[model samples]
Target: MDTNTKAFIGESATTFATEIGIVIRNDCPMNFHKWDLIPEAMKTILYEKLEGKFQLLRTNKAFMKYVDGRLHAQWVRTRGALSRHWKENGGKTYPQRARLQVHSNCWSQDDWDHVCDYWELEKPRVSMLIIFYK
Candidate 1:
C-alpha cells in the first residue's frame, strides 16, 4: 500500500483502539492475552471504521495484516503508557483512587481501570515484555 494509505490505517487503528476502549473493556475477557482474540463485534466495528476511509482493506490481506499490526502496536503502547504512569505516580501500593488517572483523553476512569486490569495478568505482562524487547 501507499504511504498515505498506510498512515491512515495506522492512525485509524490507534484512534479506534483508544477511543473504543469501552467496547474492548466490555466485550473482551479480562484475561484477554492476544489482539487476534479481539471479539468479532469489535473487529467488525474496526472494519466498518476503515471501510469508510479505505475500501481495499476488505479484500487485501496485506492491508488487513497491517491494520492488525497497528492495532496490536496501539494496544501495547496504551498498556505500557498506563503501566508507566502508574509506576511513576506511585507503584501499585498506592491507593487505587490516586492511580485512577486516565491514560488518554478518550479513556474514562473505568476504561483505564479495565485496561490496566488486563495488563495486570501475567500472560499479558510476559507477552508484552517479549514483544517490547524484540
Candidate 2:
C-alpha cells in the first residue's frame, strides 16, 4: 500500500497486459491459460498446448476482457512481469509469517517446509498460477 508497491504493481500490470497481447498475437499461451472472453477457437492452438495445466481463474473479470488481441497482450505482459517480480522478491527479506501460510497450502506441506527451509519469504495475499514456458 506504499507508493513504491503501488508503482511496481502499476508498472507490472502494464507489462502483463503487453505480454498477453503478444501471446495472442503469437498464438502462444504464456501462462498456460486460455482467454475466457475469447472464443476457444481463436486461441485453439495455444489452448491445445496448455492441456491440463489450465486452472481457470474465472473470477478475474479483467482477464476475461482479454478477448481482443491488442488488450490481451498488454494484460499478459503486465501479469507475467509482476509474477517474476514477486518470485524474485521472495528470494530475500520475505515475510516469514506469510510465507508459512503459502507453504501450508502446498500440495505437500512437509515437502514445502523442507524445500523452503532456507528461503526467507512473506505470506502473499495474491497468488499467481502462470507457467512461463511451454
Name the top lDDT candidate: 1
TM-score of 1: 0.57
Worst ten in a row by lDDT for model 2: 1-10
Relative to the unseen true structure, what is the C-alpha lDDT of residue 101 in candidate 1, on a scale of 0 to 100? 62
lDDT of 1 by residue, 1-134 (tens): 35555544456555545544544333333234567677867777755655554554556667677666655665555456566776665545563643466555224666666655554443533433445553
Could you estimate the TM-score for every candidate? 0.57, 0.25
Segments in model 2 whose C-alpha atoms lie over 4 Å from true places: 1-9, 28-38, 44-56, 66-134
lDDT of 1: 0.55
Which runs in model 1 stand beyond 4 Å of their true positions? 3-33, 118-134
Clashes of each: 0, 28
What are the lDDT figures for the candidates, one per model? 0.55, 0.42
